[model samples]
Target: MAAPTPVRRGAARHSELFDALVELLLTEGFAHLTLDDVAARLRCSKRTLYTLAGSKEQLVRAAVVRFFARATERVEAAVAACATPADRVAAYLRAVAAELAPASARFVDDMAAFPPAAEVYARNTAAAARRVGELIGEGVAAGDFRDVPVSFAAEMVTATMVAIQQRRIAGATGLADAEAYEALATLLLHGLARDPATPARPSAGCRS
Candidate 1:
């Protein structure tokens, strides 16, 4: 068998380190985390950690990005596995909840408090909206959903999720992010459902 390429080997190493960092980040917020602290926990040298990122902030950002990227991949796969568009949307939201279940309150708070991490989260949420919009478009094409403007509906969902994440809605309504996402999926799916008694609306192409 051929030896693994340097890039592949590096990715494997980084994956291990990222896993450890994620666990620690869940328990401790990014604001109080340091390279040395992570190095000590992972039993790796500071130099080893520096190989992945130039600084602590960069490291945290990289970890957050990598973690969410992996989670999104999982969600997309689950969504694709569903036969119907409604099932796909539900699968995506459920996959997201499963991915986020391990995150503690401290981790969520840290993502909001840290600017770099917050930016990573913002990008992830935007990507999710685009994906959801595509799913809605597919549903319309399949005659499984109402002829709602996909872009408008997707933006609404994204905006609502952001509000929940930032604690704006959560603070006012006492709803957790997970609960908000569940409610979002329920509301969106219900609103888009094609009535058996009524005729389907005309298709409006809704691309992300």
Candidate 2:
């Protein structure tokens, strides 16, 4: 077989670099890091970093977008593997929590402070809420959920998600963001369960 083309190799390298950058930001936060710092952390030259983004702010924004894009893909995969609507919903939230497990408190705080990154997070949150609504509607139609208003239930979940992202839930309940997501999944699934005594079926990759 022929070796990969130059363009393909470059694209692959860019992807690897971006993954490293996102991991770094998620672990350490971006607010205190300069371009030099980032370059040093990634073990790449500043020129290579510029190839990904023209400026530090842009790089951070791009990383945030990439993070959520990857996360959404994984979350959807989890939901798709589920056979029941209730399990899909539970899987969605559980996947979200798993995706967010790597993010540190500092990273969350920095993302909130950076408007571009924050906007990306906000958009993802809204999209998640809509996805939850759709899942709830499906459950209701399947007679798996109670006759609750889908819109209201979705909005409540959205509000809780926002609070989780903002650290309000942590402040109020002492639950970390990921922990809050787990609790949300449990609460939502139990509340929506047609038989309160029966537990929602766990989906692939989803914990109890």
Candidate 3:
């Protein structure tokens, strides 16, 4: 049999690299990140680093995206595990808070110092808002939520989350990720709740 083609040596998923990236981002902050630090932390060669992730910028962006995705997945699972709509919403917030550990807190601070990464982050935030708007709409249809402007509501929640992140870094008047999620959910739900005094409104113009 012909020998199998040589496996090209390049970056694998490299969980270690991602973990290291996150750890350093927290300890050193973003602007101060250097490949040498990651290599030192991982005790890997600089050559291995290059093969694993291209540049500091690439690594930071990838690590942030991957971290958030993993966090979201776990939070989604938490939300699914709840039996009541109220429970599910509360659990979702907690899950989100738990995901924003101290390390993740530092990533945003660092991202702000770099314009290119910052722009990527801003775009990502908008995408996240659109995706979450869909979930809020689902709640409304189930009668668990009142009709609210879906897009606007989602943007408000996302903006609030950003503020929470900033607060976490500031170490003053901090809201744990879970706490922020719960408070926001409650605030939104209470405002949008249907009642004798408040008729059910339709989010007719809201986008899918």
Candidate 4:
């Protein structure tokens, strides 16, 4: 076997650094930490950290982007394994909750305070809303859900997600972010369920 090339080695090191950076930010946040602090915590030199990004703000933003990119991949994988539209919807939201389970409140607050990181989070939230809309549409087409306005339902879900991210739901309901996501999934599934009295139509391609 050929030895690993320098480029491959550098890429592996960068991936390791990114994973460490994301773990640090998710648990402890970035607003209170300087670049020096990050280097110290990661047990690396400032020069090495610069290889990832030019500044602390940019580094945090990159980490945020990496975190969401990984989370989306896992969430989609979970959704794809489900056999029915309802199962897909539930798996998507629950997978999101599992992915976010590691994010501390401090990290969430820091993201809200940092404009660049916050923007990344906002974009991901919007994407998640669009995904939910697609799942809901599938459920409706399959007769598993009511034929409600897809856009309206998606918008409502988006509002709830924003509230959860901003901690409004936490403040009002005392639910953690992960718990809130689980609740949202349950509520959405229940809300979209077909009425018991309604006759069941043979769903095309839906598995029991």
Estimate TM-scores for all models: 0.85, 0.93, 0.69, 0.93
lDDT of 2 by residue, 90-190 (tens): 88999999999999989998999999999999899889888998999998887778889988998999999988877789889988788999999999988
Q: RMSD (Cα, Å) of candidate 1? A: 4.7
In model 2, where do residues sit more than 4 Å from their true spots?
196-208
Clashing pairs in 2: none
Expressed as tens digits, the lDDT of each residue in 120-184 for candidate 4 is 88899889989998999888887778999988999999999988877789889988888999999
Total backbone clashes of model 1?
0
Q: Write the per-residue lDDT of candidate 1 for residues 18-118, one digit (tens) a residue.
A: 88887788667677777787899889999999988999989999889878988989888887677778888878876777777777777888899888898
In model 4, the Cα lDDT at residue 26 comes to 94
lDDT, candidate 3, at 33:
51
Compare candidates 2 and 3 on lDDT and give the better one.
2
Query: How many clashing pairs per prediction, in order?
Result: 0, 0, 2, 0
The segments of candidate 1 whose C-alpha lies over 4 angstroms from its true place after superposition are 1-11, 196-208
Backbone clashes, candidate 4: 0
| Candidate that beats the other on lDDT, 3 or 4, i.e. the better one | 4
lDDT of each: 0.81, 0.91, 0.63, 0.90
User: Distance (Å) between predicted and true CA of 109, model 1?
Assistant: 1.0
Candidate 1's error at 165, in angstroms? 3.4
Q: What is the lDDT of residue 152 in candidate 3?
A: 78
Q: Output the number of the lDDT-best candidate.
A: 2
Write down the lDDT that model 1 would get.
0.81
Residue 1 of model 3, lDDT score = 75
